[model samples]
Target: MTTVTSRPASAASMAWAGRASGVWLRLSVTAALLAAAGNIYALSDLEGIYGRETSAFVNQAIAQDAVDLAVVSPAIAVLAFLARRGSLRAYLTWLGAVAFMTYNYVIYTLSVHVGPLFLVWVAVLGLSAFSLIGGLAALDGQAVAARFDRAPRRPAGWLLVIVAALFTMLWLKDIVPATLAGRLPQSVSELALPSSPVHVLDLSFFLPAAFISGALLLRGRPWAYTTAPGLLAFLALTGLPIMVTPFVAQTRGDEPAWAVLPPIVGIVIACLAVLAGLMRPLPRATGTPVKVPVSRTDRRHPPHQDAAA
Candidate 1:
């Protein structure tokens, strides 16, 4: 008969697990920041479209955007706060609650402007956020690495790199035509949109930052853990204008080029879904000796003892 033995969780393994929590908290904030930054552009022109003359109607319309900000910003901030060593699920749950609140507000906020059709967007965002929160909560760092200690597997860090690459490509596609043409390019004019090269550059920064930040998480490096929030801040700032602003609606007539945002937004959602999926804990089997039943006499007198007798 064979006996199974259990291994104690090691410090290094525990450290890795702790860092996963930090990575997830930072990622949640990154997503929230993206939503916040996207709103910056959407909200910037709110007064213009709704018109200062129609202040009452316009302010009422945009109130929900402010509420969205209120719901998400604090959630991101709280996650960041609780992202210390050894607080994984609690931080993720807090962050998830924050995400849930934001999505709830998103439903209300989108409802005010577009209609029931856009409900899918809100649902997708809510579901994705919950998935990330869940993945972080369920991660078992020791078990994860232990199961794969000998086997080769794709690195979790690759997901962030892929997202960064995709965003980089989109940013280039969005900006190159304008930069080469000079004068904010034809797209801005066609879309009649307000844009700054500075903002475009700022958006481009998130790619390298996210890739680097996620790389740190993957490598289990010290600075990578420390700098995650800063990286997330970069992500949030770059992405905020996409979510909150009424930029899409405002671009209808003059700025056809600005219409690129909706597709980009869709891509961001898809990328996050993929990222969350990749982070999920995979079921792993460990090779251990299977235990078999033994008689009391056999247990009392092991093979060596029986031989000696």
Candidate 2:
């Protein structure tokens, strides 16, 4: 019989992760700046910018831009700065912010019409995507999991599962029936978008991520600890835009999705609560050592060397 041992990450891999961290930090900061610029322009009354998009979609876009400018962009910069110091909690939060930007602009890049800020949108999208990828690459999942060894996984896991299910049902209720009936969902038609970017993105990526993260969390897997917080952050950020879109629509004299906003607000609050729960038990500064200051008496003489005193 041959025996094999699991080895810790090699110095080379660790060094690579360090380099990746630096790369992502720079990329995320650039993405944040670009997102801020792009969002400002989107929120502005730039002539022909929104361009033939339905009022509903444009109003939602305004809401998203507002949130991105006021919340997401600043979050990315601040969290990335903190993550650079190498805390797992900070890294997860930073990753979540990048994911929100990346996910958001994917919808913006595809849905919004071509205009002056198109390249800026594309640039932010690309930077955010790479930052998200690099941030994930830099994670040491097992090490991250170890810090949350005392976290209440079961409740948090179930909470994530419930949130995932709620969103799944929310989308699929519109999609599944419409698909079977061979007709477009009302939202798609109403919005006049070439396609349903939210549906496509959610079904293809975000929802699945939620389901996987939730399932793994239930199993108490090491990777789940690393994923759940970031997922929660994305949900929280995503929900904010959704929650505000209705109000934005109302303010603009469009018919607001008032019924949905309350539920969305609830979901956002749930995400935050679970995020705090998951993060509560984590030891601060994952790999960093804490220093204790020596008192003058201790500095002057060691306890075992009484004669020296």
Name the best candidate (by TM-score): 2
- Candidate 2: regions farther than 4 A off: 1-20, 281-309
TM-score of 1: 0.39
TM-scores, all models, native as reference: 0.39, 0.84
* Error of model 2, residue 98, in angstroms: 0.7
Which candidate has the top score in lDDT? 2
Per-candidate count of clashing residue pairs (backbone under 3 Å):
25, 0
Candidate 1 lDDT at 133 equals 50
Candidate 2 residue-wise lDDT at 38: 79
Q: Which residue segments of model 1 deviate by more than 4 Å?
A: 1-70, 77-85, 89-158, 186-204, 211-266, 278-309
Per-residue lDDT over 44-115 for candidate 2, one digit per residue giving the tens place of the 0 to 100 score = 763567866888888888889899999999988887665554444666777888899999889888988888
Model 1 steric clash total: 25
Q: What lDDT would each prediction earn against the true structure?
A: 0.43, 0.73
